[model samples]
Target: MHYVNAKGILSNKNGMNLYRGCTHGCIYCDSRSNVYNMDHAFEDIEIKANATELLKKALKNKKEKVMIGTGSMTDPYIPLEKKIQSVRESLELINKYGHGFTCITKSNLVLRDLDLLKEINEKAKVVIQMTLTTYDEDLCKILEPNVCTTKERVKVLKILNKHDIPTVVWLCPILPFINDTEENINGILDYCIDSNVKGIICFGMGMTLREGNREYFYSKLDKQFPGLKEKYIKTYGNNYGIASPNQKELMKIFYKRTNENKIMNNPDEIFEYLHEFPSKDKTKQTTLF
Candidate 1:
């Protein structure tokens, strides 16, 4: 991995990606795409060495106690997190400043920060999000090689939920003719229901393939599942949005299950829930956990 001082830590939307690249090795990782213009190699993992300090400053100056989100562009609980603890330190800042916090990751290592998460949630809000693409463990290893499998991630969700920490699941990039099936979706929903997740954010029952990610995804398809690349080429061509063949039926099952389960299936509502700062609740504010 290479290190560099990042120009800025947080985006205007209060999202921060401390590392430019990821080692989690998710075959469908949009971060690995070339359009991001990451000059460094994808797996090499670029480190924003100044991220923690910059985050401290950003949090200190903010008057309102709003949410600080991460793990959108890269997973925060990647292997290097244990060594650097940048995400941990940044969380310390957020917790200290009485700001809300949320992170989306596929790694179970997030459990390591349970104490701090509980503290933050006690005072404000802290949401833990995990992405589960496949319910089958073997398929998980191939889809997301470096991170924990779906079962382990679901276990983390259960543990966090047990502690009253709100959880969300990202059921996305459901590959066409691959893991995009009713059984897979049902298995993942079972985990969500068992774990008592507050929300499930899924844009649709499909994946996106652009200039940079399209090439990498096609190459992986060729190597991992022979003859799949040609199928994708014939089906998708140069177009970007790669909707699954089972989109209609899968979506039907998805909405029905989510609504019946009372899980927040609407993306807009979930985003609002994540972004809103509940300053009106003085008892909650006074806790200042």
Candidate 2:
């Protein structure tokens, strides 16, 4: 882990990455892709030492409150976060200034901030976006080695639902031959349905493989799956979008199940929901006496 003095915190879209790179060790992490030009090792987390100060200033200066999002490029609740407390402090600042909060993570450590999330939701909104790629426990361990498994993530989602904090699921990076089967799709959707997630964001029934991540993913495949790397190379042949052969059938299941459950499956609509701030009057009314 390393620290750097950051010049800014939030993006123009009001999203922030408190850390650079990751430690979750997901085999298909897009952040590791060369397009991002990360200078450090993938697991060596880059902490924005001054992120909190920059965030406080940014939030204070904003004329209107907006949803503050994180964990787009890096999961905010990575293991190192347990000690750094950067995410916790960011939440405290967001709650202090009365801004909505949303984060994408695969860690159960999010439960530790339940109190703050609930507080912010009461005033504005707090959406927890979790990624669930594989439903099988053993496969989930192999695909997303370091983070909490799918069942634990589902449990976290259910807990968030019970607390009245809305949740969304990112059902993505579905490795073609590895986890793109109808069974895998159905299993993950079942978890979403049981959890009562507000939405499920899936970018089709496939994953991408660019320069950096493609190489890393192939290496892991060679070690874990054995002979799968040769198959991927032959099948994909340097293509970016690695679509599943079962994409059509699996997407049918994805749409049918999500529609029947009334969960939002449209990415644009879900993103709009995540970004939209609650009406100020509604927030003011909550505290009115």
Candidate 3:
């Protein structure tokens, strides 16, 4: 791990990445693509040394209160977070400024900030988003090796639900010929339903492959799924979106299950929910006045 002073923290859209690069060895990580242009190795995490301070400054200058998001390019709750505590400090700042908070992560370590999240939700809003790629515990280990497994993530969702904090799940990157199956989709959907997640974001039933990530993905496939690299090359040579042959079938199951469960399934709609700051506190104050 390494540290670097960041010029700025929040994006124009109110998102920030406290770290650059990730240790989670997910083979299909798009952040490794040449399009992102990282100067260091992917595992050598670059800490944004002044992220919390910059975030505080940004929040203070905002014209109106809005949700602040993180963990887009890298999970904020990565193992290294246990030491840096940047995410925790950022949450404290968001709560201090009365801004809503949301983040996308696969780590159960998010539970460490339950107190801050609850406090923020009571004041404004706090939504926890988790990514669930495969349902089978063994397959989940293979896909998202460095982070918490699917079952453990589901437990986090359930616990958040019990606390009345809404949650969303990213059901994506379903590797073609590996995890793109009816059983896999149904199993993950069952977990979402049981946990009462507010929504599920799925960009279809496939993962993307590009110059940098594609090469790394193929290398891992050769080692883990032997012969799969050749199949991918033969089928998707130079293509960006490596969609699954079962995309239509799996999507049918996804839409059917999420719709029946009353969970938001549309990507645009789910994003709106994540970005929208609730007015419950404001309404209560107005009512009292």
Scored by lDDT, the top model is 2
Backbone atom clashes (below 3 Å) for every candidate: 0, 0, 0
- State the displacement of the C-alpha of residue 118, model 1, in Å, after optimal TM-score superposition: 0.7
Give candidates' CA RMSD values in order: 2.9, 3.5, 3.5
lDDT of 2 by residue, 6-93 (tens): 9999888888999998888999998999999999898889999999899999999977778888988999999999899999999999
lDDT string for model 1 (221-251, tens) is: 8889999989888898987788999999999
Q: How many backbone clashes does candidate 3 have?
A: 0
lDDT values for all models: 0.87, 0.91, 0.89
Task: Please provide, for model 3 over 13-42, each residue's C-alpha lDDT reduced to its tens digit, 9 standing for 90 to 100.
Answer: 888899989988998899999999899999
Cα error, residue 234 of model 3, in Å, equals 0.6
* lDDT of candidate model 2 versus the reference: 0.91
Candidate 1 colliding pairs: none
Name the candidate, 2 or 3, with the larger lDDT value: 2
TM-scores for the candidates: 0.95, 0.96, 0.96
Instruction: Tell me the lDDT of model 2 at 98.
Output: 87
